[model samples]
Structures are given as C-alpha cells and as structure tokens.
Target: MASASPLIDRHGRTISYLRISVTDRCDLRCRYCMAEQMTFLPRERLLSLEEIALIAERFIARGTSKIRLSGGEPLVRRDIIDLARRLGRHLGDGGLDELTMTTNGVRLGEHAEALADAGMRRVNVSLDSRDPEVFRHITRHGQIETVLGGIAAAKAAGLAVKINMVALKGLNAHEIADMLAWCADEALDLTLIETMPMGSVDEDRADRFLPLTHILDDLLGRFDLRRDAHRSGGPARYWRLAGTDTRLGLISPLTANFCDGCNRVRLTTEGRLYLCLGHDDQVDLKAAIRDGGLPAVDAAIDAALAIKPRRHDFRIAEGSAPAVARHMSVTGG
Candidate 1:
C-alpha cells in the first residue's frame, strides 16, 4: 500500500470527507429508507466508540478534514456525544476542519446542547414533510412535532441547522415549495433530494422518484434563485434564494450525476469502508485494526482508495432490486 497524506483515488479525486455510521438502529422507519420490520445489527458487531475514534484519527492523519457522524438516527446511539467529543478534539491547528452530523431529529432535542458543546457548529436534519398526517404516513409512525421540537432545540443551542427533504412525486411534491418557504421563514437552509434506489422498502421507488429538474422548473417561476458557489463539502448544487438568507440545494443523483467530483467515503458501523454509495467496493478496517492496529488500517485504506470507482451504477426501474443489496441506513445517509 502507498503512504500518502491525502488519499487520492485512482480516478484522481481527492478524498477528504469521511461519513461514519455509528449504528444501524433507528427510532423511526421511513417508507423510503427501510422496511418496517428491518433487522438491525447486533451491538457486539458494531465498532466500539473508542475504536471509531481511533480509526477516524487515522483518516484525519491521512488528510481527512471533514467528518460527519450519521446513523439511522445518530442521536439514538448511547453516549454518542462522547464519540463527538472524542473526534471534536481533533479540530483546530491543522487537524479536522469540521465535525458535523446527519440525524433524523428524533432525539436531537435531548442531545443538541451536548453536541454543540462537543464542538459541532452545524447539523443536517432529515425531515420530509411538515404536515403532521403526511409526516407520520411517510415515516410510518414518527411524530413531526418531536422532530420540530428537536430542530428548535438544536437552533437554541447555537447550531446552524439544515433541513434535508426527500422529494416524493405524489406524496410531498406539492409541498416542496411550501417547505422551502417554511425554511426561509425559519432562517434555515433547505436541501431538496431526489430519492435514490438504495434499499428494499415497502413502496416502489420509481413511483416516488421525483426528478429535481421538474421541481427546479416549478421553483424558477416562483423564487428568484441564482447559482451560488457555496459548497458544504457534499454533493448538493447550491442556489442563493433571493429575498431570504436561506440557501437552497438540490441533490439529484439520478437525473444529474454528481460522482465526478466525489470527495467522500462511508465507514459502516461494522468497520467496513464503502468507496461508493451505489457500489460494493469496501475495505475491512475493523479487521485491519484488530489484526495489526493503526498501521494495518492505514495500509488497508490505501488499498481501498487505489480501487475506488470513478462513478456509481445507480438506476431505478419497476420490479428492480436495489442498486446494491444494502440499505441507505447500513451505509449512512
């Protein structure tokens, strides 16, 4: 394996962002995310908090500057704030530049202050609909009020919050504009995402796959949107919404491929590093660590980067299997 500071894949993209899924367990079962009766990994199979921090340290040492902690609902993990604090220590003076999270907002109300105290300045919360009935239907059994309260708490704790909404054709498509306006009113950033074919869920993804192009066309007539160069170290194309401080982002994985500049990799809870979201290319860092500690893990990472694919094979069709067998929760959102 090659010894390098910043990991560069064979495709020549610099890898600087690392997303770690601390656990696969979630408090809610969103229809687009997973099955209602999903089987979660056993606790013993997950990387201990200490091990996650150690491996994350290796990535930081290799020039990973941004780290985002995610899960089915990251706040659901016990002592997750501890992990944030451990990794937060890496910030400042030529170390990790940013430490953030992607959560469902179910438990954010309870942990927001701790997370802010742990050095997190921002977070991305997944919320599909503001309508109570629609929200419960999409999430199967989630209370929108709980999520809203969590968002309130996060903001109160001085964390900049961004709302992530998965666009669904018949379900929430009519509410996208309303959601954007609500985001603007709340002084929050809003990102519209096209549903990806990741896991086997109850509904047909093709029916819910609302191309962002159609949504953008509708918004163009209503809002004064201009292309913005703001990048949040993710795959979203940003636009500055005129008349408000809200920045709108669109993540269209199917219609507009964003893999050419992919700069991130995912680390599963089980210690597997997935090169691409829609591919199975992986390296077992947990085994590497248990077998030979940090040096072995470093070599394994280099080997994985050498084989990272230039793009992912993502497609959506009726009666089709997922792009990969694994769910989005397994790889983190």
Candidate 2:
C-alpha cells in the first residue's frame, strides 16, 4: 500500500471539512435515502466513539478544522451526546474551529440542549415538507409536528439552526414559498437543495426532481429577496428575505457543481471515507484502526485524500452514469 499523502488532494486543495457518520440507523425511511425493505448495518460493524475520536484527532493534527457529525440519523445512535463530548474534548484549544451536525430532527427536541452544551456550534435539520401528510408520505414515518418541536428546541438551546429542504417537484415543490415564509417568521436560515439521482429513489420519477433555477425564479417572482453578503459559503447560495432577519440558501449540487472549490470528506458509520459524492471509491479507516494504531489510520485518510477526484462527472446531458448506491442517509449528508 502507498504511504499517506498529507493534507493536499490531487488538485492541491487543502482538506479541512470532515463529515463523520456516527450510525447507519435512522427512525424514518425517507424515499430518497433508503429502499422499501432496508438492511441496516449490524451493530458490530459500526465505529465506536473512541475509534471515531482517534481518527478525528489524527485528522485534526493534519490540519482539519471543521467537523460535522452526520448519520442515517445521527440522533438515532444511543449516547450520541457522549460522542459529541469526546469529539469536543479532542477538538480543544481551537483544534477544531467548528463542530456541527445534520439530522432528521426526530430526536432533536430531546437531545438538542445536551448537544449544544457539549460544544456543538450549530445543526442542520432535514425537513422537506411543511405539510404533515406530505412529510409522512416522503419519509414513511416522519412526523412534522415532532420535527417542528425539535427545531424550536434547537433554537431555544442557542445552537444556530439551518432548515434543509429538498425541493422535489410533485412532492414538496408547491411548499417552497410557504417554507421560506415560515423561515422568515421563525428567523431561521432556510436552505433549498435540489434532488440528485444518487439514492434508491425511482430515477424515472423525473417529475419529482425540481431544478434549483426554477425554484429561485419562482421565489424571486413572489418575494423581494436579495443576495445576502454575510451568508456566503461552500455550495449554498445565500439570499436575504427583504425586510426580515431570515435568510435563504440554494444548494444546487446537480445544477451547479461546486467541486472545484469543494473541500469536504465524508466518513460512513462503517468507517469508509469517501472523497466525493458521486464516486464509489473509498478508504477503510475502521480496518486500519482495528489492526493498527493512529499512524495507520492517518495513513489511510491521507491515501484517501490523495486519490480524491478533482470533480464528479454526473453526466447531466447523457444521464447514463451509474447511480450512487450509497444513499444520502448512509453517507450522512
């Protein structure tokens, strides 16, 4: 095996963002993230808190500053607050600049305060539909009331809350305006994400896939929104709702690929590190941790970074590329 390649990728980009999936278990079965009959990963295969912290420590030493805990639903994992505490300790003395999480918000109302106290800076809650019935239809078991309660609790806990909504055409497209209006009222940052053909969802259901451009155009027609200067970062395009403190973001990963400036690496619950969203290539850090030590784990991460593809070719025009088998839930957003 080749030795570690340090922090730089093949394109010489510095890797700083680390997205770690704590568990492959989620309460809801979102149509886009899991098959009808899902075979969740067994318990033994999941990475322990210690193992996760060790890998995080190694990466922090190598210049990683931002860490985001993700999952099939991060809150689904028992004692996730403990994992957050351990990670917070490892990231002491400004080692990690920011610690965040993305969840479906089913358990947020119960754990939000504890998570905020444990050194988490913010949270991004995935809520695609405002209508309770639509939410249930999309996520099989999700309760809009519970998610809303979670969002309120997160806000009360003092953690910066971002609401992520995937704007599917026939599914939740009509609710974009309402969602944005609700965000404005609640003073929460709302993000509209375009659907991608990367999960178990029916690819032929093209009607459900609404492009970001269309969403933006519709929003502009209805609201007096303007581009916000302060909220710009990563792939999310920010816009401020006129006369309100709330802001909106558009994450057009499919319509506008920001791979050139991409600086993130995703770690699955099973400990596989993926360099890109559209690629099957990965490095097994869990195996290294079980067999070797921190040095071995670092080497695996570095090798993965080195092999990180410059960009993903989704083949928009041809639409012939193979779909990404790892659902968004398993990969932890």
Candidate 3:
C-alpha cells in the first residue's frame, strides 16, 4: 500500500526480479568464485525464513514478479527446501509469477525431488567444465560425474533445468564445443558466461577471460543462432539452436554490458540490497527489518529503488582492475 507508484529507479527501470542469497557458505572451492579459505557470514547474522519471506513480500507487492534463490550453494543450507516451499507460495494470483534457483548442483541429486516438490519452477546449475580434471581444477575436486548425476536427477524430478558454464580461456575455453555438444545431446538449456572480474575471482582473469564474442562467432559460423525473446528479467540473451529445441544463451557482462536492461537486484545473505553486481552500494535490509519490520523494509526498498544505478560500470571502472572488488560468493553472484 505504501509503495503505490511501483518500484522504478531514477532511470525509470522497473525492478521486477530479486535474487536472494540465503547463505554464503558453499561446498566447492571454485577458482573463479571465491578463495579456498573464505570467511562467510555467521548464522545469527543471516535472515530467518520469516524475515526473508517478509522482505520478498514487500518486493512482490511492489511489482516484483520474479524471485530466484541464490547462494554460494543454496542446497548447502539446511532448511533451503523449507525456505523454497515458503517462498513458492508468493506465486500467481496476486503474488510473484515465478520462483527459481541457481546452484552448483553438488547436492542437487539428493534435493532435486524435494525442491521441485516444494514448488520450485526451475533451476540453473553452474557446471564450468565437463572434464573431470578440468572440473576439479576449476572447482578444486568437483566431480564431473557427480554434477552430471545431479543434473540428471533434477530433470528426473520434473524440473526444467539449465546449465551455466563460465567460459575461462585456456582453462575451460577449449571445452566449449564439447559442452555444447553434450548439452545439445542432453537437450539441456546451456548458457556460456564471460567471467566477471569480481575481487579475487579475477586474479587470473586476464589469462582466463574468455569473451563470448569468440564463442558467438563459432556458433554463428556453424549453426544459425535464432534470437529468442526472453520474459525473465535475467541478463542472458537467449537463442534458439537452428533446427533443434536446445537453447543457447550468452551472458557477457564484460564484453557486452547488459546494464540498460538490468531488471534485477540482489539481497545478500546478511541482508544488504545491492543495486548492481559491480558496485558496493547497498541498503541494509537486516537493520531495517530489526528496527521496524515491514514499514522499515518498505522504506528501505523505496530508498534502494530511488538510487539504483541504471547500468553497471564493470566495463569501464578505472584501471585494469574490476569495478567492484568484492568476492562473488559473498555478493550473491
């Protein structure tokens, strides 16, 4: 009721998608995600299900129609399924239109059925490499078969699934063709994302940065990449694979910035509402919730929307360094 004007930022962009990071803890030690030894938010500091739901309610009420649960690995959280079940209630009728999640898929095999049963619409699993050694090198002991099994389990549970592959030059870049063939054979939606220069994740990015430009060139040179319209507020550009039903997508925040169409914001596990993934600007939602509940939350959301940056500055920061120096895991990337 308080937010009658809708959640539009200064640039007139309607904020309809929200990515909520339930926990900062993760099982893998991805080379490009976070350092092997990382400090995560304490349990008491993380928002409870009630707090998460209330905050989500405020956003949904203000024209936020999409919600995606994210984390260092959401399945690592004990009550994540319960959280998903609770959050899924805010869909359809007068609530959110969709609720999905992004995960590493390490534990997906065990939780896929429960997650889908809990009302999850779909899921995106980040699997960088299909080779066991490369997967282990990128994720520090991540088993390719295990993740493949998880992906299989998710599909078996009747949930639509997508695979996210971060294209790292020299490391996993050579595997792009292999990944595409595998995804095509499996009929899985596959998206190749250029690595973001997020803090420590970018330490070797100069060497590892694999632009989607080359990948796109390869795909276009071989097959017809028919552009597809996207309804989700995500940044990935969708494409239909020629004569097949398999889909292809590219998320090139570095090479081709999609800031002008940024329809989403993120809530960190500790409750900071980040306007842009490449900036440190945030509104402290945990403080607002603790201080004044929904009234304060509404005010915080309003304040956040008022100053939300129209586009991120990941391309042109200052030096060769990334614009934002925060870790992706903690930032809820």
Best by TM-score: 1
- Ranked by lDDT from best down, the candidates are 1, 3, 2
Misplaced by over 4 Å in model 1 are 1-4
| Residue 139 accuracy (lDDT) in model 2 | 92
TM-score-based ranking: 1, 3, 2
lDDT of candidate 2 at residue 147, scale 0 to 100: 93
Off by over 4 Å in 3: 1-4, 315-319
Error of 2 at 114 (Å): 0.4
Candidate 3 lDDT over residue span 1-333, tens digit each? 344558888898888899998888899988877877787777999888778888888888888888998888888988888888887877666777888999999899999999888788689999998888989988987888888889999999998888899998788877887787788788788899987778665255677777799888987876777999864568988988876777888999888988887888999888999999988889999999999988888889889988888777665233466667777777675
TM-score of each: 0.98, 0.93, 0.95
Give the C-alpha miss distance for residue 46 in model 3, angstroms. Answer: 1.4
The residue pairs found clashing in candidate 1 are none
Q: Model 2: residues >4 Å from true position, as ranges?
A: 1-6, 90-92, 202-205, 230-233, 315-322
lDDT of 1 by residue, 1-333 (tens): 222567899999999999999999999999999999999999989999999998998889888999999987888889899999989988895789999999999999999999999999999999999999999999999999999999999999999999999999889999999998999999999999988899899888998888999999999888999999999999999998998889999998899999999999999999999999999999999999999998899899999999898998789988888898899999999
lDDT of each: 0.93, 0.83, 0.84
Positional deviation of 64 in candidate 1, in angstroms?
Answer: 0.5
Best by lDDT: 1
lDDT of residue 184 for candidate 3: 79
